[model samples]
Target: MPLPKAQTLFGYSPEAPELSKAEVSRRFDELMATIDSLPTRHVGASEVAQAFGEGRGIDFGARPGNAFEALTKALDGPDIAKAMSSDALASVTSALEALKAEQPDLMKDITPSSPIGTGLVAYDLEAPAKMLTPRPTPLRNRLPRKKGIGLSHQFKVISGFTGTATGGVANIHPGIGDTTQTNFAPSGASNALYYARGPKISYAGYDKTVAYSQFSVSDAVTWSAQYAGQGYQDVRQLSRTSLLYSSMLLEERMLLMGRGTSGRGFLGAVAAPTGVALTARTAAGSEVALSGFTTNVYVKVTSDAGDFGQSVLSTAANVGVTAGQVVDVTCVLPAGATGVRVYVSTGASDPGDASRWYAGRVGYNTFTLQGALPTSGVAASTITADTTAYTNGYDGILPICTGPDSGYVNRLNAVLSNTNPGSEWQTAFAALYDAVKADPDRTLLNGSDRKQLSDALKTNSSSNYRMTITQDQLTGVTLGDVVNTIINEVTGKGVAVEVHPWMPQGNAPIISDTLPLPDSEVSDVWSVFNVQDLLGVDWPVTQFAFESSSYWMGALLCYAPAWNGAITGIKKA
Candidate 1:
């Protein structure tokens, strides 16, 4: 059959000569008649039924060239010579006509389409800015973190030797024979003499203890919230960061204040008062009127010197008076005591109950009980009966240095209200360094205490001094907003002062990184022991939302407590 002319196929052509509409219609009809007169080609069932072989014998190259060619071959067979046969052409044309009927619904026309209008708000079209999370946890980040073994971390502390020395040397002699007499002494002797004993090697057995603590944090995110935050933020990651940080802040607090709910928290670095007591005197004067003194009640007071701790019960004062009678008990406050808690016995002489205690500061130390006596019970329990003692948490530096039996640190009483307050503070600081005979890594104090120290320095100085801060091409000058250091006269070294936000005001602790032990495996004297370090996990979503949690199981360990020292009872000038 002859091919249709270009002008007849396209109905019109730019380069072709103009032709009558009747001539073009006649050419198109002749092309259609020739195509329809072609012989029909049929695919046999045997050929279409052939299946692809498996294994190495399978020929992947036997696949049809493309989807269109494959469909055409399946319906008309692979004979290129008869590809345009009437039956084969009709089968392909029928399939194509069906596809064309659905083309308008499935395909989009881009020619007539325009960009979206500008009437929408800018906020809706633009992406959001990045979010910010600021975490201010200094002690937790600064203290060294380490991994521990078993349920608890154990270590041995060697205090001193218990061996005794033999002053004078002894003489020894062997049995004398006929010809020669044996003598082991500076002077020769005939009689047999002997020193009775072996060498004595004795030393103190090391004290060993275990440290352990654990805490956890959890959070949840709804499906809708997470899905809504898809492009704006990663809600899951943000939740994880927040949870982990929250856990760390708790750990930091525990490091400072160890007495958590049931004493299951980390042991703090500061020590609880062990043996300090206040002196008591009882008389009937006018400090405050007594209220519940129907019977004779025994009064005892305990002192809390800054972060040192609430001291043990003091000497009981027996006051005999009726209800509403004035009970004035003059008490002698300890050298460094800042606050006091007064406990009264329900009976004549039993102050063991923990329910009848009244809390008071130093100014409120006067006992003014003015209520009718309802119930009479024993005295309140001490810090030891409950689990408030330093058991779960390790004994921190402050405890090790200032503990009753520690004999390592020099405890100096500072009076900030003295006439020469600056000189007094300087003397106390110098005394502490002098006792230790070395400088500390850094001096930790509350922000209020730091201000007091700075004020003291300014008051002590001869004049308001200022240095000329000249800046040139190669020179630069830097100034501090506040005084951050003090000079230790003993060591002639500048003590670096750091403000601890959580530290209890009115006291400053000088901590040394170097342990007193000659051979220490730990690099830092103070370190956090982790049986299980920080771990985070996501729970399987039961509903449309998911929950995540994080855990940190550890305790603070102090290798050498004596190397660290603190100045207690610091009153801000």
Candidate 2:
């Protein structure tokens, strides 16, 4: 029966053999090596041939002759011939054609030359190596040796006042009577005695001395006179005068103190000068005495007596005073005294005794001296202008124009800087057109004017403006869209778009030994074309497929010799 089929003979079968572990392992290794060595273009063909060979002891070599013949015979063999009908043959032929057609154009340009046998080597073989020259020493030193110095200063001044006042007399006098009679005779001698001296005869004056003697004439007369005076005149008068004067003399003393102390202890507190003590005796048998008042007051004493002397005592009544209490003695500076001194007296009287007082304390006024003395090094100097130090340093430069001018200058500069040059005319025109389209401002430019403007911008020179045009023009298009557009535009021009996704920008990946079809290209094609249409024989194949095919073919060519090397035990060329 047609020489039993290989599967039927010697226990061989058409169904894939249940290979032993060792056999399977060996077969898999051989297949892998074969696959690795062949060109990618033959990958499908080789696979087909291998399936046939494994099933029917056929051999497919690197050259198509033996492999193709073996494959043809295996298909037509008595046991398998019926399987290889006209339809199967046609399908295989079509697949082969499709695979061949997918080969990249770049592959045809490659010309491998034998370096050992050919005399047409492009590189020089006997050229001597040139010795590298040493770099010359630097011409000048640029390191900084010393740093510069900077210093600043400032000053401040403060001044003001405090004082107190007390005690005056309340005087009273009798009212004048309407009667003018000097004397009157008495009915009783005792009553006459009360009117003795004839009612004091003269009514010219109500003097205390005159009225006293006339009142001693009788206790009844004296008592009546006192009652009449009770509701009469009341007057207040100063019983004692005390003055405290601070003049140029006192200020001079304070300034001297300040200069001696530096700024450390510039402030001083002065207590009131001495004054007489007031004592009162009560029925409780205890003595209540009032000594001098104590208050913490301050002043800015300076050499400028003009300003210092103008200082007056501030009111201290609100600070330290009681209802029954009184400032019996006022603080004063003696007329002949040279420096500042405090004096005191008793009973609101001026003692005129300069020795009765002493200087309790002295103070230096920092406020007055602050203005006169130079500022300390620690003070901060006010900055009035930008400096060169800011230009090269991390500190930002202070703009020359601050407040109002900054905004105006910035806007003006921006507008001026954006003006298109002649070379960037096209880019500028495109940008303006885009802007107008987005927000058509007829008031800004009429249709005719816009066209003219566009024409002018088209001739302008500016890379920045050109880039703007590109972005604006491509608005929402994806990378795939760009490829499609390029392909469409370049089609029918004999030159097809060589889209090498894995290629470096300048050197196309089409020439690479291993190129992969970009997902973007596949996605883009799928978007516009049906999968069935793409697989159809007549549909145009993509550049990505072509490049990937060429890459695989190149890889196969390079490794073909390696396969022979493995079979023959020779080193690959």
Candidate 3:
């Protein structure tokens, strides 16, 4: 079999020549007929598959050495191989056709007929970003936050003891033995001895009470379950819980407001001015109490008609009546069923015009009258009930300090008015430190900002009086800001200061509630934890409900009363 001869020029019959087109084509045909048989097209996928064998192991030592070696070496290097092997290349190549036939969908969108390129041009062409999410919360990067808190643990416990109990009431003794603190000695050998009993311990008992607060999230259970594995929850849910804590702080601050509704006491009233009372005339033997007299006010009495007036009963001083000021009045009414009248007056008694006088409302200290006064009938046109006695807000530290009695025995020197109230802190504190010094235990002076307080103690700049500021106090405070100072009286020579938020800004309180002091009756805010599980769940009972934590507390200012004294009512400059 000979190959077809190549035609030249006009396709005419040509003479044989060594380099002629017909002779060359004829020779090429003779050479091809003598060559071994070969396939017409390039190697197919099946042919490559055959070369790869069962293992598809590429080997340089196989038939077709250089071509196999080049393709196989590219297999060892990924970048080179990525460009070399593919579905389209496999169809046109022969030596390494087997390798390309086993090609993965590495070029995800590439195909046998597809044009290849580089970069994003050849990458996924639909969009540059991934599919958008519905409500994706970005990861939060911030400092960890701590929320609502209240008073210290000491306020919730008995002053001298520790540990939890259903109710821990500690009885503090005053150590004043021998029936009385005083002893009697006769001049002769016959001093009478009165020896009686063994249980001479005079104990003041202080008890504990509890407080609570609670809150619930809207879809808390559902949301928590949804975001169970997440590090943070929805912003709304976090706020709802934090609000519960805020409520706790609010209640706690009020409890610390010195006094409140009922006996929901904080610290005992230590700053009340004593002898600030509405008293009856001592000389007249005609004493009376007023209905609306909540605070000390002045009054004048007179005998307009001398109806039953034996003596003038008044608060005015008897003898030296200054031109404008009336310290006391001298008046009295006989004991009989007769009407009497009292009038509000800072001036001398006006005898002529009854219309000019305001009748004083009467109560408790009842006295008899011999005859009716001219202006005694009507409830109006005269004095009404006094308003100075009552108030809704807690009795601030001032009133608490002013009014102390037996059991809560703080030595009170009641005065009608502290004229020089500015220097009252020095006088009051000197008394307090002196009384507690004998106990051999330290004391704390707890209070908020008050007038002249800092100025009064500025001289004792040493350890005698220094401030222990809290983290909360550090905020919003500068050099001149009125601040509560916590002073530690460690050596029995100084006093401790605790600036509490709930303490009234006007009337300062001194206590050991925060920093610590010797056993003073007013130190503990007794909280009895009947059931203190603050965060408990109640499903159907409350609508997606969460309860605020709560507890019961009562101020226990009854232990070792003599150990505490407050110098209240100093004004600020």
Candidate 4:
């Protein structure tokens, strides 16, 4: 026996299948006549069948017996030509007529019997301006604090002077009635006078000149002593130094009396001197009392000397002290002492109180001694040197994934390896797998479809398909390239395309007995066949079966198209 034709075997026999020839012929004639007489009519199945009968192979199916059936059959064709035929066109025309009859206003343009023209009119209309609501009040009205100069001073010394001198003099007694007078004066009177002439100088000198070239003695040399006493008073007013003390009392207590609630015992106090003394003493007379004292206290002292050891005197006790008690302490100013300070603490044994004591009063002074005064005419250049080591430690290895590239897998890996792995990317990958497994349209397929799908994906230029490949199948492809390919394919085919990245599968597992798939074999088959088949002509074969079962056997299938016919075949395998 002759082998059956491929067409017959495939259910498309050479002999037309048993169909109503007279009904099909009548339907074709009526549809063709209607299409020839009407505008805006679409080809129907009858037109497609008539075209087939006119020595043209039917790209679609056999003719239907009526306009509706014929149009439906034509529209279901793989190619557009069979659907755009005379009978199909006539069916569309009859549809238009029926629609016109049903809606008189819509038919008015085509109904020549009516006097109306196109039935649509253009008119200008104005839209009222929209009213705007009042703006809301601001949450805050306070302005930022302005920067101000603290304390500053400047001084200039125009001039200064010092002097030293040495000299010898002799005096002679005058006779009681002698008329001659001897005057004594310095030898360099003009020189001494000139030296004292300046803007800030004044001088006075006793004048006397004595010369002894010869000596004479009386018959009886007698020495007479003359004494004169002049009394002058040196007066000075004694100025007493005053000390000012300030203290802060910080007391904390917790009661655990009821319901066995735990309690915390704390006692802390602080005391500070307005200014430090040059010397401190433990003797009774020199000590001063601070105003505020809690169970425990801390004191800080400040002085112009900026010397902690010399200025600050502190006493502390670990045992809790009375809320208010005058602990004897002494501060003394020894002879020739310039400044002094005292710091006292009464608190827990912990050294935290000592730090606070230093900070509250003595910190500024200690800082000054270390040459850390902000006003020491120093620049901020030193801070840069200290921070250089920290800045240099930050190499490019700490990559920052920003902008569109942030979601890329490589960027995600960079973050995982170098930064934080428990980030959004990991969560996203999990979410994506979950979504794929949850999809209802996914199915199991043979290996051939997987290859075809993979190849299609590799060559397809449609961004929509590209997105499907990456997002739905988890293709691990570059997002930019995927997007570009999808765009090219969609534009080449003259079809509108929309590309959306696949959402992560979240915490859901890729495959589980509780999931929609039955077993690993089913999942494998679905990954190889169903996923690629769903990708259609826009995806690649390699994309479907790019790796062994190790890579995708247990992986969830995703990214089936909503518009695709393959969605109907998906089932639990």
Candidate 5:
């Protein structure tokens, strides 16, 4: 049937003007659909997988041959009964035919050996560790101090009579010539008039002393957790602060020694005289017998007097070599044979020296560290270290000397041989007191001494020593006995006494442990300047970080020597 006439608005018959437009539009749409059907761009395997997962349609540029999906579909269909590969089908059918042709014998079952018995394999992990106990740090907290900050310091004082005196004996004499003053053999050339003078102005000086400590680390070392518990010094867990603390102790020790660097305010002192032999050596066959040391360990044998010191290497799972091995010691020559030191080591190896072996602690040989043989078999190297005696206790403090004519009248100094300690202590005190009595600076002066003095006092002192008035005059005098007697006498006069561990030890048995000094702030006796307090900072790297800290300070005895006096050679043997 003939279609209705097309209108320009919508129909497409052919006579209307709009018919052409509408036909063109329809043709454009068909062209677009054809273009869309053609492959537009390449899609990757991932895109294919993604599309499949999304259940979306995909053309894949027309049909692809022998695809896995087609094979899979065919296998699932009725074609499953047919062999897929010629070899696989032939082998399967032949094997089936043979099975039907003849039955084969079966073999026995086999099993693998596993699930190891309880003690068969050692699966236990060994954790390596050693106990560390720090040695005593003796100097830091002991010294007496007047804590403050300032520039160079000094103590103001008055010493000798400063100016000439007047009004003693008149130069004009009323002699035999009565009223004729010149006639009394008053050649007047010998009239000497003495007058009292005002106190002399004096000052003591002190300079700063710097004390410091430092440590450093690398990143890898601190970060590795695997190394946490396996070594002698577990540096991973803690900073080795022994060095820093040691330095601090050393500074205090030096100050009290007053032996080294007299010019730098008399710091770093104390040296015993050269002994007959500072060291002793023995050939093999002399090492003492030991049993507790099981193999590698570090050991140190120090003479009780610290006159000699040494360390030895060791092997594992074994104690000392009972019969052979050279043993050398660096201490005062052993007299006859009496070991003076406590030979022991904290670990198997020397923490400060890498060359030394890991010798376990000494005294380990003793079972239970008691009974008959416990301490009986110490190393032959242990021997008595005798000390040389100084002439007197005063000698310990006199590093320098002054002349009577030097106008110092020794007033700037005090000298007294410890002749009769019981009596001389009083004399020494008197000399120091008299020297500064006029200066009026005695108020702040206190006294300090080393542990030796305290030990000496404790050793000799008795209940009677504490009781001065009721004590028997015939009682034996001990170092402590004499020292306390003197200190008690001095303290009653308003002076304070204290223990200073850094004081030089006595060279002589009687006086070695006695550097008791009447200390004072005379001008801040040790005017210390803190250039810097301990400052800790972090230095980080790509792998780890390091913690570093440092401290700086300086101390000096204010120059007023007269403000304080030390009894260097006190003896109460």
Candidate 6:
């Protein structure tokens, strides 16, 4: 059948032109040919213009089709810009302005004059500078603190034996009479026959003077500076805090080595001069070639009443000897001397030479220098001078522990050889714990002393001190952390090794116990008797500027001197 024209399909005309079957076939063929002649894929702008009319598609031969591109070309060409319509040019200009407002030119050079280039343009600065000064108060923090109602704190200590049981056991025949009754009789007919005299109890009283430290600051700073622009905001508050720290330092020194010569500071732990006195040598023995001696050396003796309590060195006696010859000296035994320590000078003629090398221990008054020369020993200068009548200050820990009263025995040599740096410390600590019969909690020494111990441990190959590495754990490697504690071989308990910067060199104090005194409580070993804690007040001002002051009043009281002791005369590692 033949198809009608497009006007007939729309019902525009019922009698629309209809062709025969051959004419209709020819028209369909011609339509298909026209569709094939058109582009099957994308064509360029010129091809599109040629395919469609120039006015309908794009004027590619004359100008760009995009309004942006056409505007850019017109800007460079005055003739093209004149030909462009005002509305089209206005639209492109509006778009460019909008873009300029939204996006800044970040690629532009930044100069010193540019406000955006400066870092402080909108920066927020911190108010005050941080304070990094180191202020450590180890002893003050550990000791107990208590309040006192009076100006002085006093306490009583038992000094002698008590009870009436001085008689010893005795054997007697069953028939005749008991010998115990006769042996237990009173002396000088002062009491009834066969009745033993009672033992009188003795006590020693001790008093501590309250000490104080104060600081003052000018009030003018408070008014002159309101903010922290100069690093500190409140000068008065800073001064108060600083005073508290400095006062603690003063108190700590008094607790350790104070010699209250001025009657202001309290007595310290190593300030007592209570060693047995040796005025002069009774016999300066003959010089012999027993050991190699390069120069003349001084000799001194220390008496011990059998207890670990060692006395201070006696007066140094100069014994002139040449190289390859050693001096042999003898002295009358001082009363109450159960044992004696012999010391020699390190080739110095000065009788008061600070360095005193340990020669040996002797039971008799006679001492013979033997073996090679000693390379390490205690320094006499480090030991504190004995105070007269103990009125200068209270006897510190060293004198109390090594004095005749406490019975502390120090039998080991005072020197530590570099070849075996850790041996003396380890042995001394172990012996100290055993003598005290308690596990020591801490061992306080100088940093140099601790370093020596640590270095010795690092080089030691003993399994007890070193760690084992296996094949299965070979990926990650570490050389082990520095050890800060040592386990007692006897008690199997670890004692913390603390390095105290303020600790006197050559003195290592072993503290067996410590208690936390939160508020007016007491410690087992020591306490701080406080007449008044840290207090501050603004002083009466006569001028326009005012002043403030802070103060602390307290004294350190050692309860049990026997429970704590020190390893003195430590020269180095």
- Which candidate comes out best when scored by TM-score? 1
Which candidate, 2 or 6, has the higher lDDT? 6
User: What is the full ranking by TM-score, best candidate first?
Assistant: 1, 6, 5, 3, 4, 2
Q: Write the per-residue lDDT of candidate 6 for residues 1-573, one digit (tens) a residue.
A: 123342222212123244455644443454445445544456786778665764565433564534344434644455434544443334334444443444333222334544355633554666455678777877778777787666566665432222211112222333333343433434566565553333223233344344433222222334454343346456656665666666666556556544333355442222212232222222234433544444566667665322223455566676655545545555544323434567666454563545667766654455567556565776555445432212323334433444443323343323334455455546755665554344567777777767766776666656555455434455865544454887766667787889987664455666666522233133466676666776666777665544666566655566555555555544343
Q: Which residue ranges in model 3 land beyond 4 Å of their true spot?
A: 1-239, 258-426, 433-452, 455-492, 513-558
Off by over 4 Å in 1: 1-134, 161-202, 224-234, 259-402, 405-438, 461-481, 516-522
Q: Compared to the true structure, candidate 1 yields what TM-score? A: 0.48
In angstroms, the error of model 1 at 505 is: 1.5
lDDT of 3 by residue, 1-573 (tens): 121123321123223222455544554354344332332446667766765776553332433234434444544444433443242122223323433344433213434443445433433344223424232111001111123234312233332332211123334443445664332334354755445333232222355322222222322344444355244444334444444454344434433332332333332211111111233432333423223321233434422211111113333321222222222322332211011235442223322223324453211112221122223443222322321121232332223333342112232212212333223334444555444432212222224233244544543334544544445555764344342432223333344344444333233334322223434343332222212223423335353333333232222132333334453222222
Candidate 3 lDDT score relative to the true structure: 0.32
Write down the TM-score of every candidate: 0.48, 0.10, 0.30, 0.14, 0.34, 0.47
Candidate 5 RMSD computed on C-alpha atoms after optimal superposition onto the true structure: 23.3
Q: Which of 1 and 5 is ahead in lDDT?
A: 1
Each model's number of backbone clashes? 10, 24, 56, 60, 55, 10
Worst 10 residues of 5 by lDDT: 363-372
lDDT (Cα, tens digit) per residue for candidate 4, span 211-303 = 111111111111111011112211110000000000000000000000000111111111222332222212243323333333444333322
Which tens-of-lDDT digit does each residue in 482-534 have in candidate 5?
23323425434423333333322221111111112344323233233333433
Backbone clash total for model 2 is: 24
Best by lDDT: 1
Ranking under lDDT, best-scoring first?
A: 1, 6, 3, 5, 4, 2
- The alpha-carbon RMSD values of the candidates against the true structure, listed in the order shown, are 22.3, 52.1, 27.1, 47.5, 23.3, 22.3
Higher-scoring candidate on lDDT, 3 or 5: 3
Report the error of model 4 at residue 156, Å.
14
